[model samples]
Target chain A: MVNEVIDINEAVRAYIAQIEGLRAEIGRLDATIATLRQSLATLKSLKTLGEGKTVLVPVGSIAQVEMKVEKMDKVVVSVGQNISAELEYEEALKYIEDEIKKLLTFRLVLEQAIAELYAKIEDLIAEAQQTSEEEKAEEEENEEKAE
Target chain B: MELPPQIQAQLMQLQQLQQQLQMILMQKQSVETELKECKKALEELEKSSSDEVYKLVGGLFVKRKKEDVKKELEEKVETLELRVKTLEKQEEKLQSRLKELQEKIQKMIPTAQ
Candidate 1:
C-alpha cells in the first residue's frame, strides 16, 4: 500500500511539473503579444513606399523610366518602421503557436499516462486482495498441520 | 481519446497566430532590406564624392599671371559654376530623398520605437 501511494505521488508530481511548464509558456506568449503591438505602432511610419508617380514609357523615346530614386530613402525608412512593428507580432505569434503545439502533444501523452495509471491501480487492487486471501489460506493450512 | 473542445479551439487560435506572425515577419524583412539598400546607396554616394562642395567651386589650383588672368579666370569660373549648378541640383535631389525617407520613418516611429 505504501509503494502504491508512492507511485501515485510520483505520477502526480510529474503532471504538476508539466502544468507548470505550460503556464510559463502562456506567460511568454503574453509578453510576445505586447511586443507585437509596440512593433505595429512603428510600422505605421512606413507607409511611403511605392508612392512615386510613374513616368510614361514611350516606345520610341530614349527616355528610359528613370526610377526617380530620389524618394528611396523615405521608402526605406517607412519600410524599416514596418519591419520592426511587423516582426514583433510575427515573433510573438510564432512563439505562442509553438507553445500551443507542445502543449497539445504533452497533453496527449499525459492523458494516456493517466488512463494507463487507472488500469494499473485496478490491477494493483486485485493483486492486494489476492495476497490477503493467500495469507488466510496459509494460516488455515498451518492450523490443520498442527492439529 | 478525443481531446476537449477547448483544446481544439486553442489549437485553431494558435494556427491563426502563426499565420499572422509569418506575414508580419515578411513585412519586417522587406523593410529591413529597403533600409539596407538605402544605407548602401548613401555610402556609395559619399564614397564617390567626398569633395562635392569643393568641386562645385571651379577654380585654378595654381595661380598664373597673364594680361588678364583675372578675367580669364572669371570666365572659366563662370563656366565651372554652371557645371557646379548641375551638381547642386543633383545634391538637392539627394537631400529631398533623404527628407522623404525621414518622413516615412517618422510616421512609423510610433510603432517601431
Candidate 2:
C-alpha cells in the first residue's frame, strides 16, 4: 500500500521554492513599474519649445524637444492627457507601467496563497509518512507476538 | 482474514489526489505556453509597427518629395498602428486568461493533513 507516488516532502519543498521565485519575479516587476512611472513623470516634466500645430509634430501634441541623446534623435515628447494614447512609445510605456503594477500586485497575492498551499502539502506528506512508518511498526509487533 | 479496509480507501484517495494534481499541472503548463506565445506574437507585432512608424515619419527633410514620403509613411504607420492596438487587446485578454488558470491551479491544491 505504501507505493509512495507523491513524496509530499519533496513536492512541498519544491512548491516553497517555486513560491519564492514567484515572489522575486513580482518584486522585479514592481521595480520596473516604478522605473517606467519615473520615466513618464520625466516626460511630463519636459519643457515645450512651442511650435505651431501644423502637424508640426507627429501626433501634433509633442510640439518640439531638442537634445543630444542620440538614442531619441528625431523624436519629440508630447504632454496632455489625449496625447498619451496616440504615439506608440508614449502609449506603450504608460500601459506597460500599468501592467507591471498589476502583475506585481497579483503575484503578491498568489505567492501568499501558494505558500499556504505548500505548508498544507508539507503537513499532509508528513502525516502520510508517519502513518506508513506506524503501519510497518505494527506489522513487526504482530510478527513478534505470533512468534 | 484481511487488514483494515480503511487502508484501501486511503490508498484510493491518495491515488485520486495524485491524478487530480497531475491534471491541474497539465492545465497550468498549457496555460503558461499559451501566454508565452501570445506575448511573443504581440512583441513582434509591436516591433514591426515601430519600424514602420520610423520609416515613414523618420526625418524632417525640407524637399517636397521628402515631405510626400513622410506623409505616406504616416498614413501607413496609422494603419499598422491599429493592428498593434488589436494585438494589445488580445494580449490583455490572454493576461486575464493567465490569471484565471493560476487561480484554478490554486484551487486544485489538495488538502493538507
Candidate 3:
C-alpha cells in the first residue's frame, strides 16, 4: 500500500510539471498572436496609403532613404518558391487581406487549444488532491491497526 | 507486496497523459518560434523603400523586386499560420483525451478524507 501511494505521488508530480510547461507554452502563443495582429494592421494601413506619396524606406538598421512612389499601379508580388510577379495595387491589397484572414483563423484555433489545456489541468489538480487524500487515509488506518 | 491492479492502471494512465502533454508543448513551442520569425521578416520587408529586394532561396540570396519579396513574406506567414492551427487542433484533441482519462481515474478511486 505504501509503494502504491509513492507511485501515485510520483505521477502527480509529473503531471504538475507537464501542466507548468503547457502553461508557459500558452503564454508564448499569446505573445506571438499579439505580434501577428500588429503586423496585420500595419499591412492594412500600407494598402490604404495613397499611391503618389513619398515614403521613408529603410535601407538598413540605421539608414532610411526617401523615395517617391512612381508606379503605384504595378507592384511586384511573390508567387511562392522564390518566384515573383507584377501585380496591381488592388490585387496586392486583396492578397494581404486574405493572409490576415488566415492568421485570425489560426489565432482562434490557438485560443481553443489553450482553453482545453486549462480544463485538463484543472481536472488533473483535482485528481492529485484526491490521490493524496487517499494515501493519507491509508497511512492513518495502518497506524491505527498497529496501535 | 503488489499494488492493487486498479491503482497500477491509474498510475499508467497518468504517466501516459504526462508524456502526451510534453509532446504537445514541444510542438507548440516550435510553431510559435517559427511564427515569430515570419512576422519579423514581414516587418523588415515592409520598411524597405528600395525596389530591389533579396530573397533567400535554397540558402542563397537572390535579387527580387520589392513587391515580390513582400508577397513571399505574406505567403510564408500564411503557411506558418496554417501550421500553427493544425498543431493547436492536435493539442485540443490530446487534452480532451487526458481530461477524460483523469475523470475516469477520479471516479474509480474511492474518496478518502
State in Å the error of residue B102, model 3: 28
- What is the TM-score of candidate 1? 0.24
Candidate ranking (DockQ, best to worst): 3, 2, 1
Q: DockQ score of candidate 3?
A: 0.08
Q: What is the per-residue lDDT of model 2 for residues B31-110, given as tens digits with 9 covering 90 to 100?
A: 55554444443333333223222121244322223234345434555555565555556556555655565554445444
DockQ of 1: 0.01
Q: Between prediction 1 and prediction 2, which has the larger DockQ?
A: 2
State the lDDT at A132 in candidate 3. 76
**Tens digits of per-residue lDDT for model 2, A1-147:** 345535655676777778788777777867866776766665444313223212222345665643432232123222211111123545545555656677777877877787787778778777887888988999999999999
Candidate 2: docking tier: incorrect
- TM per candidate comes to 0.24, 0.36, 0.46
The full ranking of all candidates by lDDT, starting with the best, is 3, 2, 1
Best by lDDT: 3
lDDT of 1 by residue, B20-112 (tens): 545555554554455454443333223221122111124322222222332433454455455545545554655565456555545654544
Local accuracy of candidate 3 as per-residue lDDT tens digits, B1-113 = 56568867887988987798788789888878877866765664564445776665786667877776677677877987888888788888888988888887777666421
